[model samples]
Target: MAVTDKSVLYQHGTLSLLVPGLFEGTMTIGELLQHGNSGIGTVQDFNGEMVILDGHAYQVVETGEVHELTAEQSVPFATVHFDDPKVTTHETKLTKADVEQKLLTDYPYKNVFYAVKIRGIFSHMLTRVVQKQEKPYPNLTESTKTQPKFKQENVEGTLIGYYAPELFQGVAVAGYHVHFLSNDHSIGGHVLDYTLAEGDVSIQPFASLQQHFPLEDPAFLKEDFNYAGMSTSINKAEK
Candidate 1:
């Protein structure tokens, strides 16, 4: 993979689109990697959780089974950037809340974006992967209602994701959005909660964001998005 600017975030599709059930994939995994190596997203039709780490992509299905994705695989939404952390902090025994708080307190930037990576042993990890949706797909909130959640204890893995400001809520997740992948590639999914046994938290702040839309998709072009309920649905689905 070619090196990309660590200071820039590349995103495909808007979070708002998923609010009204526009789950069709617009970009292939190969095209996504051309922009970055570490990030998070969902596969086409919200089939599974996606984690891009060390220049490779992995899909964690509803059953908590991990599979490395082929280049031809696609996604409807994703955020990626070459991860080159300028700050690395060693944290121990930190809960999910503590980690989020620390990241907020340490950086204290409300408008900019941050790429985050945490690698270590986790005492407890709670994650969920939404099931694949067929045609007449339900909105994100409804589709996630039957999501399969997984709980793992004392596992070593890495967390990959980004932090978007509240001002860009409909464009991306307003807060930390991360996914987990185990070292052995046996289990992983969208991170709901976790307790870090000990780990290194690395972060890279970015001031630039490049948003790309699926202009070729007719559904994306014609759908009347529910801007008013986007935040509400996003919050519900994310939490």
Candidate 2:
């Protein structure tokens, strides 16, 4: 696929972008909506999981319930793109790693970001939702220790994710960062691992990026944001 400005990655905040004191959320749901129609992110207080598809944002709480964002809900971190990816559908057996490997191998574009959407019925799926945190929040790696995990069988859902360039290390996960939303909408969260019995995977590569930083928040402006060991912290938090 040829790279073009028509495809742009719109991102808000950064992974471990705020280290000393994590800002709860700097951008509201309404504000994020203007950027793109599809992507994944975490909600304020790290209370639950967020998956945006088809221009609507849905919050999946720790209890495994999915809710649509209302009022001025916000997020400290999110990645979205105006997705209209080239579509390809196939029936095959694959694991989470297999899906990622296949995409990278087929596309083989390491420098650009790809908006990925995979829908299928899973033979096995494992997912985790981060717990809500109180003020004086801990770093992301520490916060994941309390994340509630669930396993489901014979489930159908869509996997929303992105493949980021390794060059964007501290800024993004640098690899596959994916979240899951089940067909029933009752069960979904940050994907840990899964076995897809059958599914369709679509990929759209973006040659450009547009980032929005939250400067209005006092904490964002004041925090020193120690970057020491950020690579280790992000690896632990994502897995």
| Candidate 2 ranges with C-alpha deviation above 4 Å | 1-6, 18-21
Q: List, residue by residue over 1-239, the lDDT tens digit for candidate 1.
A: 34477778999998888888888989999999999988998889889999999779999988888989899999999998988897999989999899888888988666789988999999999998889999999888889888888988999999988888989999999988999999987669989999999999998899799899999999999998878878889989986
C-alpha lDDT (0 to 100) for residue 86 of candidate 2:
73
- State which candidate has the highest TM-score: 1
Compared with the true structure, what per-residue lDDT tens digits does model 2 show for residues 1-239? 11223388888988766344374888888878778778898888887888998888999999999999963989998988776877576857888888888887887677788888888899898999988888888777667777888889989999898888988887888888989999898679999989989988899888777777787877877778667788887887786
The Cα error of candidate 2 at residue 147, in Å, is: 1.2
Error of 2 at 35 (Å): 0.8
What is the overall TM-score of model 2 with all chains considered together? 0.93
Q: Write out the backbone clash pairs for model 2.
A: none
| Alpha-carbon lDDT, every model | 0.89, 0.82
Candidate 1 wrong stretches, greater than 4 Å: 1-3
